[model samples]
Target: MSVVNPLVRAEALEARAYQLRIAEEAIKRNTLVVLPTALGKTVIAALVAAHFLYNYRDLKVLVMAPTRPLVLQHRDTFLRLLKLRPDDVQVLTGKYDPEYRLQAWQGKSRIYFATPQVVNNDHSLGMSLKDFSLLIFDECHRARKNYAYTRVAQAYISEAPYPMILGLTASPGADREKIEEISKALYIEHIEARTEEDEDVSPYVNPVAVEWKLVRLPESHRAVERTIRRMLDDRLQRLSAMGVIRKNPKYIFRSDLLEAGEALRVRLEQTPSPEERGPLFAALVLQSSALTLYHALELLESQGPQTLKLFLERIKSSGKAGHRAIVSELVFNGVYRVLESSDLEDHPKVEALEKLVLEQLSSNPSSRIIVFTQYRDTSAYLAARLSKLGVTVVRFVGQADRGQDLGLTQDQQSLLLDRFRSGDIKVLVATSIGEEGLDIPSVDLVVFYEPVPSEIRYIQRKGRTGRRSFGRVVILATEGTLDVNYLVASRRMAERMKKMVKELNSELHPIIRLGPAPEKKPIPADWIARAELPPSSPETAATTFEAELESVEKERRAKFNRELRETARRVLNSVLTAGKNGLPFEELCTELEEEGRNPVAIRSAVERLRAEGQLMKKEGRLFPAGVEAEIPGARRHVFEVLRVQLGEAILRVDDSFNAILLSADYNGPRELLRRGNRFSAISEIYENDKARHVRIYAVEELSD
Candidate 1:
């Protein structure tokens, strides 16, 4: 094909022509390309973009990345690959002024890169996707339900004239269901996965070594062990009662784990004595068990090892105030030695990770490494201890608030990653966020802090290394946690992904020899004839049950409405009588019952009123917003109502009943309340209701 785009003529890309041809063919069939990390998934995207751009000169191309930073990166790459002028590509985000963005969209930019949320928001504001011909979804595995990616794709597919779509990802997700969901969301027809076993891709991809590490917990902390076991037993009982879990029973999962930790903390706060410190210290151990158990389950899911020894080691060290005494205490008097010396060393996951880490560390001392753990505290402790031993270690954490329980902001994440890329960081200690697409530069080793319950994570962690160079992955497993379950899931997912890829290839690949397209099986003649018959009595009866449900729901709604209206009337009257001073909870409850609201629904109505801003709560008291105002006509009874008609505005609410005020132009003083309502309006009130369309720049005068 003759090249029309200047960037497509690059000498460096000529070597990729065969891959480009394959991608182009795949695009014609709406394919998915599961290339490994750093395997130039974007290169294939650019090639496909180029082919479509060349043929459909008048149409626009859209590329979407999951994050804003990735969108900018894609736009930059496409700019280089398409040989297009700078003005021909643009990165669109909601951060920009909407008016300016709407103008930019109308301009010459043919390939627009954006985060899905930005596109969805702008589309809501009237940005049309009708002219776009080709849409590309980066990190396509995220195209599953309810994500902005799926909505944007659906919008484009529905609006664009000859819509073609392409999706890219380092790893899709955990399992067949996730993969299938992404496929169905994107309407993908073909999928390509290239593993070491794949003949065509084997030459370019390298295999990595994996090791499993298991550390035995020592025996000195028997009291701590007993406390943990008892707590777990109690919690499991509660879980069983709630029907949440049916476990054979493990050493963790008790409600008292938290209570014990809280009790110990209180004692430490009360008395800094050595006697109290013993039990306090033991409590911390059990607390660590609680945290460790939680993360262990996650690690097991993703990595497949239930017991995470390194995790326990690191956490136990957190309770340590001094050196060898810390290790000695655990080894000599603690339960750590007992667990470590237990027969669990033969545990499969423990054995596997131990082998992986020792083999890799012994052979490759200078290798850059990342150990993925589930708990932040555990990861930090491990990094700190490792660094003290002279291994360069850094904790890569998610952005979470001081007491919040989620990952960090994307910016903090970017900084940590930049440090890793520059080689200033030798080891990356991270959580699951590291598993997806946060690019960490080349590393010779990747250690699973623990096995994760997610197959996608297992694959992503393993895929991290052995990209451009040889690498190794080591999984650290503890003996007893849910680690075994995670490992089993990971293996199953890998097998499923491999089988899916094989099936997809067999169906789509050229050499797979397409016989005549398989014939659509005709409906059996008897079945076709049977379909003409009416529904049976049971089927007809079941259909009637659905209609009965609708009737019942309608009746429930009508009753609900009657109760709400009565409650609203009472709330409105109470506000008027209180005259902006509102009623406390006791008075409001009594008034609600007197006003005919069911005592049972009074509390609920009060909550609903406050939530909808129809009622305001202050100092444990409730005050109504008078009533839901109605639209007035030229001949309406209430002429004093201040009707804002022209521009958007918000009435500032504050602690006290302040003077009526406005920052906008007012033609007249109108009513604040209306006749036949709970509260009556004054004789004259501010009536500047004509200013509601455009946002007012400023309020001109305050009128009462």
Candidate 2:
């Protein structure tokens, strides 16, 4: 039987017992629902939302997801199941203007579907959370750290009068600390978790047959790997001899190197004496080069020779002292020559993937397949190679430009997904971006080109298929490499996750009820009363409502403008105070945020200052206008293009360094400004934690 509710469409949603039970528990407390994927977590969210909308007529509902697509998906699902009017539901994303978002928040939209970043930004810019009765955080595992989810949830809890949060995810992860962190961030008091093994869940679960295809590295690839290993060993020995790293070279992993680098950076920050800094600087460089070699080894072993070649070529072209050092050694060891002379164009996994895709298509001609790879390079390679073999395929990656590799825009991504759903595209070669809450229920097969170590990602990837019917999963792992190790680690972590969740469920105390359990109640008749209009005509009421909306919009716009102008003034003053040394954008943000300025306001302020010529960016540092500081010597760095405009592009080397590349300065293709593109460039200016106005003397687009 379907749920019987006036707000929910009749027979639109089947009343599952588990879903209802979970919803009942969720409505009573701030809850975390850790149900497995494809088990209708959204359905449970909808049920809870419907309950609140019925019971608390004056309150609003806020649903937040990590991505724009997920936000839209939730919006559609709610619209489909609820009897709410079209105008009563709204969607907000980064694409929407802040003024429109402000109006939407203040308008009559009781149900809002939004990306967390937008909601967080809006909240920062004076949007109140007090009226929201329920805030549902999708993919709640991301709530940890400084993620937007955590900030939004914290605000909602502190601001909402009778706040109730519903955190949803397929897997919260194996780490107890992380699970607790997510719970604390979301103010979760209870957990409603279900697995496929649960008696209540099994009936609705579709079995997925998983198989592992293990392949060995070719001897030629092994030869290249041996050379890279030797190069890595040389760096490791030097670091060990310098007493920077304690781990034996044989037992060291990438994580250890990262930790060492972080530790060294912290020590460097504390040590001011140049006499002691020389060796530390040298050790830091050696550590970085060692990490690079480790990555190259992984690419060669896990990804194919072509991917490795691309990486090596980028390193060779780089001007960083560490990169140059690594390249010189590679040249001395003849690794580049070996890569150039290799006959292998791709990894063995590519061949295995081709075979699996062909077999799946032959058996089920209308089948849709999702091939998951760890790298965009592999995604591009697989898509290209598969297309050559006459398979309909497309590469699905995140919206970030990396050199020549351009990412799909939201519209492009949505259109491609639509085509894939319509059977126009048979195979989707996707990277990590496709491992999350993408709704593709008709997918017949999921191919993991490489196994990820994260249990959360592993579950999400496997959950892609086996959604609506019995599905097949084929994981391709290279024998005796990180692939095999990662596969085992992920499985172990998944098991540990299930166990931890179970333990938490058993340990968590249920909310004590003074009265009987709350039942779904109908909306009170008095709550439906609108403002009395003295028997006005329908046309008159419509005109009156429009005028009221206009008045509210004008008020919101005025308030927003006042706040933006004030923030801009503060930003300009801050930059002017910094003078020639200038301020790092992030440091400036921290200072303003400490003064209670929201990120949106700060960002708007910065943009306004830049436009008014009150502030200038030099070497990633923000400086006041009219400062004629000499440009520093140019150095090579790989920068990721964050955003592109008509004549200039914003590039980021890391968190501390950012640059602006003007069209006049860049002689490369205009597509270089495509988001997520990475390229080698020489910058003539440098400042600590500051934005640089850079000239791109030489540009080389890194291959995917």
Write down the worst ten-residue block by lDDT for model 1. 693-702
Estimate candidate 1's alpha-carbon lDDT, on a 0 to 1 scale.
0.57
lDDT of 1 by residue, 365-434 (tens): 6566777877665565556656765656677665565333356566666677767778767677887667
Off by over 4 Å in 1: 1-6, 14-18, 94-100, 220-367, 386-393, 399-412, 504-704
Q: After superposition, how far is residue 643 of candidate 2 from its true place, in Å?
A: 46
What is candidate 2's lDDT per residue for 66-130, written digit by digit as tens? 88888877876775566565446677898878755765687677789999999989888888998
- TM-score for all predictions? 0.56, 0.75
